[model samples]
Target: MRRFYSYLIYKLYTWALNGSGYNTPIFNVIVTLACVHSFQLIFLMFIAFKCLPANTHLSGWLNYVAILAILFLISHYYVFYNKERWEGYVKEFENETPKQSLKGKIYVLSYLIGSTIGVIWLMYFMSVYLFK
Candidate 1:
């Protein structure tokens, strides 16, 4: 089960990084969101497995908060180290031609929001099902 879970996470990360049909900026945003969400989920699972009391709801909640803190620290480090790359991506998108159609705009927005929300939902379900 552990190996399968690890493999699944690895595949998801790779897919997030290499997803098609988006510009660099959009891709970066997608990747960042994926990384953040996955990191939080995995960290929470680890904490729950290692530190939390088994069969306790409060412990699970505490594990969640600890995982969030850890993820925030990791995200801060990533943002600090990749500041230039992020800035460049934003600049590139800012200078690019705007999408001309409402459909295009809707598609882009939906893609971003949908993926983020989907990942969050998946993580929530996984945490609840696997840990509880």
Candidate 2:
């Protein structure tokens, strides 16, 4: 079981990082989203079996997980194949825009705040489910 799980995880990591294109925002975004999608699946599956055991037999959850997996795979492949176009687009945008460190800092701060909220919400729900 441990070997199977490890092999599955290895395949997933290979899939997530299998782009042939150079490092760019498009590649980074797709990989990051794929990782987030993978994390979400792990979280939900753990919750389903450990917390909400009643829904363990439902096919809908499997369907939902499949959809998410497909979505991320498509997104990653799309970006990987069209990397040149994406790079050109990014270059054009960057050439037209001026650097604004303050704005960039603010955006980073906002993202951190949103991520904190999401983590807190997940913890709260997990606590409720596990304790109740």
Candidate 3:
């Protein structure tokens, strides 16, 4: 079960990161929205809430938090550790004849802008929500 779950997560991450149509404007939007930090934050939040204790002052949540954190790291490590496989998928799915048109450039530019915003937001979220 754990192996299956890990495999599923890895595949999902690869798909989100290297979308089926990565060069397409819509797919780029999806990739921008599905950034790693966003998903990590969501998962950690869910685990924290689910493991929160009834006695608000209790520190029991720490154990669960730590365990979940390890699992989270493991899942991400698995995905990234298999970088060669992911790159192969990207190479396979990427456009055979790379787009050189103005529209293609615009799409790439939009993706870069959107990705920048997403990274900034993730940093802010970590500092504000996770740290303090």
Candidate 1 stretches with Cα past 4 Å from truth are 1-73, 79-81, 100-108, 119-132
lDDT of 2 by residue, 20-52 (tens): 654454445556545554565565665666665
lDDT on C-alpha atoms for all candidate structures: 0.51, 0.52, 0.50
RMSD of 2: 11.7
TM-score each candidate: 0.33, 0.41, 0.34
Expressed as tens digits, the lDDT of each residue in 1-132 for candidate 3 is 544333333334444555555554333333433454455565456545545665764468678767865676556444445435545544543453444334544554554465566556765676668755
Is candidate 1 or 2 superior in TM-score? 2
lDDT score, candidate 2, position 73? 74
Ranking by lDDT: 2, 1, 3
RMSD per prediction, one decimal?
11.2, 11.7, 10.8
- Backbone collisions counted per model: 0, 0, 0
Which pairs clash in the backbone of model 1?
Answer: none
Off by over 4 Å in 2: 1-26, 37-56, 59-71, 79-81, 95-102, 105-117, 124-126, 129-131
